[model samples]
Target: MSGRPVVEVIDPGIQSTVQAWPGRTGLLAQGYFPSGPMDHLCFRASNVLVGNPPGAPALEIDKIAMSVAFLEDTQIALAGPEGIHARLNDVPVPIWETVRVRPGDVLRTANPGRPGYRLYLAVRGGLDVFEALGSAATSLITGIGGVEGRSLLRGDVLSALPRDPVSARRFPEALRPRFTTEWELEILAGPRSAPDFLTDQDWSELVSLPWRVDLNSDRVGTRLHPHRFRWANGGSIVTGGHPSNVLDDAYPVGGLLANGDVLTILGMDGNTSGGFAVIATVPHCALWKVGQVRPGRDTIRFRAVTYDEATALNRQVDFTIDPGRVQVL
Candidate 1:
């Protein structure tokens, strides 16, 4: 605990946990993944609205009903997919904006239907926590950060680091994040494709067909499927039993990893090293789209992009998230 007590959880939504921005870095070799918010842009927007640093610890709600009681007066902000259900006590509260609260005020949210999956709630000061590996992000699979490295539970109390009072602010409406049923994501083709693995035809098909997000998808990875094509050279790589197995190699954080015919986009809690083959990498600029993907409803199409192009897109995204863009009220 690093500051004054601020809130108590009344309802812990599915997979809800404490998380911060840009999570633990330079420690992947220790088998710890940066279990930060699924949507970095949303995470930053929430923090900016409440006058907290971008990396301030906050609650990452997993698109389900949640409720919390304020233990003290403070300002808070919520951000996520465009149309979310939320409230302050009995009054409806706006999303992507800041709201002032008093002691005993209750903030609650309902399920975020198909539009998206995760939401962020940030206080005036970042949440108080003993940073594990230098972050407050939670790794549910390995019990790494967050409250004991697990999802939040009802009755949990939260504290916030002391910070100066900040006035109201909101993210622009035109710039808010949008969600759709289909997406065309760009990837840099292959650290493992080509004449040795994927033939020219195989490479063509990987990006041609639409892949649907599987229901089994989780924070660790977004599993995709169609089950229509067989790998042309999965057996060409080294293996223990499966054709897709290879000597364990550093896993590209947002790369397209293949285990047999199954395709997955490594996400926030995805592994750092694995024996599975990484065929293509989804650029960091485009990975936030992966966070909002709706299971069983969203479909993805891949396009090959150059590294320079990806970098340019990332810069564009950065501009959209700049603190100066916030509307002061």
Candidate 2:
């Protein structure tokens, strides 16, 4: 408690893991995924509230009950789309603000008011965890980064770097994000998503209707229903047995894949390379919203935008809240 801050996990909850900046550059070719927080915006905001750098390591949790015991005195912040019920030592603790914690403080989190999927917790100096490929993100598929390269388990213990306390802080109401169930995503057609991949008629249908979120969705990707498309006559060759399969290639974070009859939009822990065809890529500016789209509850419709328009929206969103704390990509 004197030299380093620590937290003991009584119940790690669902899919909780320590996440930092994504894997190092040029790592995908070697099959390493940049498995950072799915909601980077909230992750950075939590760190900022604690006076830490934007990319400092933090705990990311899904919508599940969790409890932890603080073994040292420090400052911590929780940031997310909706304020979940939390208590310290049986007293209600506020969200979106840094709160001081002392030894033996029992912190519990649960009862989400909304449908979003992620909640982030950031300590003042960041979590102290092993880094793989120059990142602290935990890849559940690869078992490579974070604590033992897996999700937090019961009785797990986590620590933060030793540092003098920063001032307790909170973000103004106007700066926090409000989540919704119906999402309209602006997309940019990727290299593989040229006009010829799908017929003009199919492209129209893709943008015109709301795609249903499937229950199979997870951190790896969000599976969607009704992604079938018409192929242009002789427009392209069949890359594999399935019409959607192509030569395995690198996939962007928001790559929309035509896997069989359904589709999947890649997430933070998505594969670095795959055989499916990516019809579009979500811009970094609005990519975090993908993480909040609760499976079987929220639906999304894509709106194709020009490259210029995508860049402009990116800048606008970044400046609207805590400017200079987040990057466009």
Candidate 3:
């Protein structure tokens, strides 16, 4: 270790704290769900900018503002909305790119102009926090991960690990993600909902109609405007004991499931086991794109893509950001 204290949280803004990959298998084994961040793309982007390896722990912030002060000089980057601004000793800093800051400088966000929910802050060598299972993620639902599996509060401090000098030196020019109004999420139909409950037209409408995001949405799952659909059965499925599916049937991360009273679009932080009817799943490649949409903005539309296309797109993205560029700092 470099003997440098990682960055510490001065004010855990509106809802800011450290998160890493996630604890999935163990959580599911214990009947707990895996709840992480809403936008993994932005999270990974910040990590890459700060020269941290993929899956390294980073900070996740909600609408509320947060202030972080470094214990030592460090290189860092911010990804997500411009509303979540950063200041070094009160000097304004840009988002989506790398910048160096000295100790005692504070970073924070301003009143947001756009409809964004989360911000990710990453530093050189990643943030140092106790890992649960294999990640540092905070699963609020089960009260696991992070500082006791809860949101960061005031007066909380975080430490950092030493980074390789070579990684720190490879800092690239600041790059910001293109936030736009044109947001289209791709979905794959699967796991069938009651088999008979959904008609061809209902499934068609799901992929065709524009559905607005409900205001009561969060990291766990997003609820969309309801649409009429029929179900063959109204009973619950038995929860089984399988390596992956404890809920009896196998389902994808972004699966669209219907419970007794709600229609939810599962996101990255969805439950590991559920008896809800599964209609579809959003492709991993297109998951981050949904973060750009604001609540009550307008009904969002889903486009259906073949499994081959989804796989191809994901592979292309991985190729675009080569791990070789990640130098040890």
Candidate 4:
């Protein structure tokens, strides 16, 4: 846990390597949104597999390819899209599972496909990056968090927290998530704008029509194609401060809102305060699923569920390692 080890970046991936903690929490305080992995559930699952606590600093890679060599032995996990080809000493490795490596091993990753955007990499003890505003998560737009609020680049040597030799074990294959399935997102009506902003037709279109993810999507907000409705209160709204549920405060991750006449799906890195009307809030459990969605190929459809049903489904999911079978290398 002391005297960090060096992790050299031989190649910077398409996107920067970002990290973040839980972020600040208080009444009437505007906290910086920690935009890390698009699929945070998988990110957290990787951390827990390697015995790291939730919210630990992990590497978040976007489309750009990356190549690095470790200075010491380490345990790591690669999760997210299919393009990421993580390797040890030039040997291919699998995603969504933990792998072991010896000192001087080289780990390289490539883009999953054209238009690819993100990848999540977690080390045994997590990366030892600086924490600002109570989080290590990077905010690219605001230029805050992660290596001076910027993306990781070539020749950057990141420090790693000391590892626990005893906890260095291979992750079971059963624990990995299937990356090749279509993603479906569930949403609830927004606290403020949902009631007064979107017309009935807009709401119906959101639930019934299939919306394609536009190439313009990013960590800030996902721009979707035009649906069949107009704003009940027009496209613009007065600026104000609100809470997670309130449109006047700041929007939270999974907040579905319209931006500049186009339907945008806001992620964790969305602005804290805005005047735009909030349409819906993607539940916590569904946030990761939404993040895994690929552009053009993915379609988002809303399904209504009762609170009890949502809770039951969330509880049914297993979030721990099975300790049953070993992952084939």
Task: Name the candidate that leads on TM-score.
Answer: 1
Worst 10 residues of 4 by lDDT: 237-246
Taken over the whole model, the C-alpha lDDT of each candidate is: 0.84, 0.79, 0.66, 0.66
Better of 1 and 2 by lDDT: 1
**lDDT tens readout by residue for model 4, 1-329:** 26367578888766665675454334114555656667766667667656677567887766636788777777787766655666777788877666777778888888646333466777777888776676778878777777778878888877778877434345554555555434567777874443476777767777887778887777787778865456565432334322112244577667777654567778767776675666777776676766666666677777755667667656544344332333434
User: Using alpha carbons, what is the TM-score of model 4?
Assistant: 0.83
**Which regions of candidate 3 are displaced past 4 Å?**
1-4, 22-32, 82-84, 164-177, 193-195, 231-251, 296-298, 323-329
Which candidate model has the greater TM-score, 1 or 2?
1
**TM-score, structure 1 vs. true:** 0.94
Tell me the deviation in Å of residue 317 in model 3: 2.7
lDDT of 1 by residue, 1-329 (tens): 76899989999977788998888777788987777888888888899899998889998887646899999989999988766778887899998889998999999988556577778899999998877878888888888787888989999998998887797898888878777778888898778766556667777888888889999898899999845344555464346555567788888778788887798999889999988778899887788888878777789999888989999988987788788998999
Error of 1 at 51 (Å): 0.9
Per-candidate TM equals: 0.94, 0.91, 0.83, 0.83
- How well is each residue in 11-83 modelled by candidate 2, as lDDT tens digits? 9987798888544556778876678888887888888788778788899887736788999889898887665
